[model samples]
Target: MIKIPSKRKRGVIISGQGWQRLQQAKRKMEMQGNAGESYTLEELSKITRLSSNTITKVQRRKFPVDKQTLESFFKSFNLTLIDSDYAEAIDAPPPVNRERIVLGGQIPLDSLLYVERPPVESLCYEAIVQPGALIRIKAPKQMGKTSLMARVLQQAREQNIRTVTLSFQLADTQVFLKLDRFLRWLCAIASSQLGLPKRISESWDNIFGSNYNATYYFENYLLREMDSDLVLALDEVDEVFHYPEITADFLGLLRAWHEKSRYGDGGSVLWQKLRIIIVHSTEVCVSLPVNQSPFNVGLSVELPEFTLEQVQDLSERHGLKWKVDEVERLMALVSGNPYLTQLALYHLSNEEITLDELLKTAIAEDGIYGSHLQQQLWRLRRYPELLADLQRVVLSPSPLEVEPIQALKLQSLGVVRVQNQRVSPRCELYARYFKLALAIT
Candidate 1:
């Protein structure tokens, strides 16, 4: 079968030498088939009557090579994973570039180190194609929220739906000064992205409020003209929470548009032509009228931390030949935080540090997380209450009861986890590092 890049690409090496040999054998079977013609992994799996995913794992050589797998390869392709071939496979090394760990910033489509999260990715996909659908994804920093949004937008393009992405973080300080100006700016950008001219301002009337003007522009001009549904994705929507006035009006407007789609009245046509995807952090503390709040509606999704299975898969992608215990030990420290786990594994896979060394110095001044921990320290100083709350959490050996709002604020910082009414450091690393940093006894 053909060799597909292992999906478990994080700080990983081939966890087992025997597994790597199986992968080579699978590749060879495809390459040497039908008088030197090759077959795709899927095609080979079909010929052998094996599950495609099983064939893919074999081709990737992701797990330990065993008698059954080797025998299956022989039956499928009349090939062997033994003798000289086996000897050569055992000696072959993993790709050198696999050690590069992605820590922060947007994870490129090619570099995303996640297993396809189900129901979440799939639900977002379903929402994008539906008429007038809005999807909200909430998660703290480094939790892969934006990465998933990128994928959803990609799916929209594949479906021939038009897409426009706007980031609130990139908006000008002056834009948030007034709702009209902000709405107009939004319209201008959307129009520009849609290859339309700046005609939104030409229709602005003094008699109409900016909110109405913005609605008129989208309904009478932009959305009205588009052949396919236009997907408007707003990332970091919570940035406006600090500007309560703008957030209340702007988000309320979004809620109005969303509600209109369900009206089934004559006005439904324009609203149905537009779909919105909003990304925000649940740590947002804003006061808005419950009746007008958009947060209450739409397909809301919260990203959960990676499970152990996913962490293991990502470790393998990094080319690390980690055993189950090694993976569990790492998780015990990082607790499957995607960025943190990948960081630890990267150091291990590339020989920058050993796993024991990583744990020993994970949050020290000269360690992998020195910069990260320092930033958190600086941020907490600005919010003494949060710093105090976290100090109490780290001081305790077990989860501590914290106010719901306080727990959310802590979780947003990526240092705490909350279940029910209790909160604790997100992982052992956070617990150990912060205990000293905060001087919590």
Candidate 2:
């Protein structure tokens, strides 16, 4: 039986073999009269203006050659590397068990709903030398906004795009009062992700040095330090809208950077070389006008709930043996809600329960759907009149304008859908939960 060497030992052996192969290739080219046509390493370095050390590293398989170096090398041979076999070999394998319950840092998988966006990796090559465009993903809670952002960052890395993802979810509530700390944290995160050699504190100090205004520092230093176009995704941006003054100031800086990149001299703006993607749950209100805000500067992408077909696909992916009829029945119950659909599927997958049993258990006293129902009830406690108004709207065949706020809130929660002055529960599951919550409350 052949036994493989340990990873470190194998790496050394493989690298040596690869280096020998490269030398052999060079020899074959020379025998084929290509020696006079192709430049030597030193000669190629002089022509491409790259150091000999860089060429030596590539030949030794110490590190992958930069795109420019590889391009120059190919150009020397009157060939292109765009469709080379070596380029395909550089791609890493996808992660095993890519599907998981929890995604990103804290979002539960059952709650996530994947939406198709412009593939993030493709943008890297297209925007390599140009100012990267902004991406705005707008969605409601439990729609998988954070998970999608995580996937985008992963895709960016696979495409050799330098990427950084910062979530405002963990930002201190005191961010409004302590702008400097907020700025420092943002810089530290960017620095860490970029593998910058400088310490976070040093980088921060260098950018903000004795200057209280962080806006200038971010535009001038932090953005400038990004050697290549970076894909920076900021999640939970709507959370900042609670602090209007800070939100306006920060977003204004982003707008300024974008504008400068468009109209100013080449080196005047850092955003000319940085790609920014901002994601947020829709807010009830905003400090800046929706159209005029910097948040609106990018392509505004909305993530919707899965269609019936998608829900079935998700169930199949989870290893659930769901029939078309079963899938339709479940969709009728959950109204294609990505989260609740998966939650039900998970329980069904774990336990040998019939559809009727699952439905009954969910609505029974102190059951799974019961708690969710009660929580919505608790939210309504502060406004009993609103709750009563909603109950009336639900019971009434026709919708009334008197309960617009209650109706809007219910619709936002994915509990009810309004159509042609008629009010209807989105699905049987939601209806059961709402009824249970009202009953116990």
Task: List the candidates' TM-scores in order.
Answer: 0.77, 0.64
| Model 2 residue 311 distance off true place after TM-score fit, in angstroms | 1.8
Best by TM-score: 1
Residues 141-165 of candidate 2 have per-residue lDDT tens digits of 5566676666555545544567888
Which regions of candidate 1 are displaced past 4 Å?
A: 1-101
lDDT of 2 at 412: 51
> What CA RMSD would you report for each candidate?
11.3, 13.6
Pairs with steric clashes in candidate 2: 101-109
The deviation in Å at residue 295 for candidate 1 is 1.6
Superposed by TM-score, candidate 2 places the C-alpha of residue 113 at a distance from the truth, in angstroms, of 9.9
Give me the runs in candidate 2 sitting further than 4 Å from their true place.
Answer: 1-100, 103-130, 178-181, 195-212, 287-292, 365-393, 396-426
Worst 10 residues of 2 by lDDT: 8-17
lDDT for each candidate structure: 0.75, 0.57
Q: What does the lDDT come to for candidate 1?
A: 0.75
